[model samples]
Target: MSGNSRYRILFAGTPDTAVPSLDALVGAGFTIAAVLTRPDALVGRKRVLTPSPVAARAAELGLPILRASRLTGDAGRETLGRIAALDLDAAAVVAYGALVPAAGLEMPRHGWVNLHFSLLPAYRGAAPVQHAVIDQAAQTGACVFQLEEGLDTGPVFSRLERDLQPGETSGAVLADLAVSGAELLANTMGAILTGTATAEPQRGEPSLAPKLNQADGFVDAARPAAAVAARINGTTPEPGAWALLEMASAPAEEAGERPAQQRVKLLGAVPEELPEGTADLPLGDPLPGHLHRGRTAVHLQCADGTVRLVQVQPAGKKPMSAADWARGLPEGTRFQAEATAETATEGP
Candidate 1:
């Protein structure tokens, strides 16, 4: 068969990050036999049912769609049967959110190809891009690999690398990768159809990047300023990094009364560096968790140094400049100190 349209294939994905690859495949002239995505989920405060981004896009493109929360038991059998009926030459997966069954793996002649955010044999698992930022990785990129049952342990077909920029959030890096990775996915698909694709075993030691939870987003000032900055940026636009702001008690209140605490999301964080000859200024170094507000900005002291809070979002409020938020703070107000033991650490 000649040309991409001659090869029938299935496209499986979910989330906004996966939409680009689906579009790229269609633009590359692939005959997308069908699209598989997760079932509609309850989203937002109202709990309205919402279709996955891929499912919604597939609907817009007028392509057949298969929705499954998971491919297991009877649902797995039915979906697999339906997929098999398409006589697919191969399948392309990008953040599909679920694992493919062993039976489904053999249905495609060229097997299933996955577009993972991180290079193979390194940072393998869900949340690769997030973990890469948190761990301060020098570089990270995308890989198109043959998918098996293991957790991102697959032979690679093609790969692309990009350097991680300082102070860049995981969300920003992932968004960039999603676009560039879409092109990589489409090229790999074309190569596979033309029988020019080569699969090679992954090299180097492996690292795990498990999914992060709400607790992972807690920003502890006890850690070094760089680590605190990394954690805050890595968790941004998702679970969201936040710190506890302690309110000062009134002067007439009981001597031993505890201060009230408010949760505030730390949207933009970066290590602060004092200008030359400013060391002798009255601001001298503040204790960890203490706030130092200047005319133009607000800085929070950490273990080694201080981090500038560029933007902050108070509970139930929109994000605002740290300087604006600090203007109304009580004289003794500061961030609540968190125990180092409660902080989240990267897995080996």
Candidate 2:
């Protein structure tokens, strides 16, 4: 809005990440009438009725709250009723899991706007942050756009881009983006109120970022080191990237053609430098399952080359240095190959 005007805002979002945007809008002089967040639900092992971080912050700011399941039927009608009653100029959504219906989207005098995690027309979906890392993107950023019917198909209003660092995790990237986007949201709303914000249609090829799951963790060893590293960092602290490794000494007969016990999650890695004198092994020669070092590094042979595992978290174990896990590995153990491998052999 202009320096002279402050728009009445109805805010919707559910996580701590959304807090900065909400607060920035308020700080930028927008009048936040009400906040719509999901109802309290069980989270974590305790199954406690945990309030959303956004809701808690809203309460502190003394704004009214509407905890609804969605904007459809009773829930939708109820939310719409509240919005109409608020007489808001517009609504701002940031990572709000619930869908905004057409009626709901049009409730405010102006219209709804969203603070999305990625540049529009790219990484448009539920898990954009994770996907960018998985794809080994060179860069990614946040965008503010007009809310539309299709998922993140909104018209762009403003954007802030950043380079993707080699060691950055999705969680870290999102944390920074949320803060940056929050400030941008405030600025955009300010401009809209003042009639300075300009809207533009999204350009470039659109990409999808589907919700990540446990199975998304499987990464082929045949992929390049850079790609593998990106996947490992992108899926951290959640549905992590993993690959199968079989013990080397297991009977070739029992292992069939390929030997592998199960999948192992990769948490951290660094590229290994080729030795000076020895000839570099081809992708298929040494195979992918060989645990290269006794400890400190996992020298798994992959498609393009080898990757050293710096840290890892096996299915049930806590995350630890790969060196520690190596020492803890059972003696006389043999590494197994990927399920797709035709022949598994113990590394000499």
- What's the residue-level lDDT of 35 in candidate 2? 95
TM-score of each: 0.93, 0.85
Q: Give lDDT per model, in order.
A: 0.87, 0.77
What TM-score, to 2 decimals, does candidate 2 have? 0.85
Model 2, 1-348: lDDT tens per residue? 444235688999998889999889887777888998988889977798888999999999998999987889976797789788998898899988888888877778878989999987999998898999878788899999999888999889999999988867787888999999999888887777667899999999999998899877776665555666677778875677787655554577466755446667888655564343322343535555455553235565554556677677777778888878777665434333343454322221
Off by over 4 Å in 1: 252-254, 275-284, 340-348
The residue pairs found clashing in candidate 1 are none
What's model 1's overall lDDT?
0.87
RMSD from true fold, candidate 1 = 3.1
Superposed Cα deviation of residue 165, candidate 1 (Å): 1.4
Give the local distance difference test score of model 2: 0.77
lDDT accuracy of residue 58 in candidate 2: 93
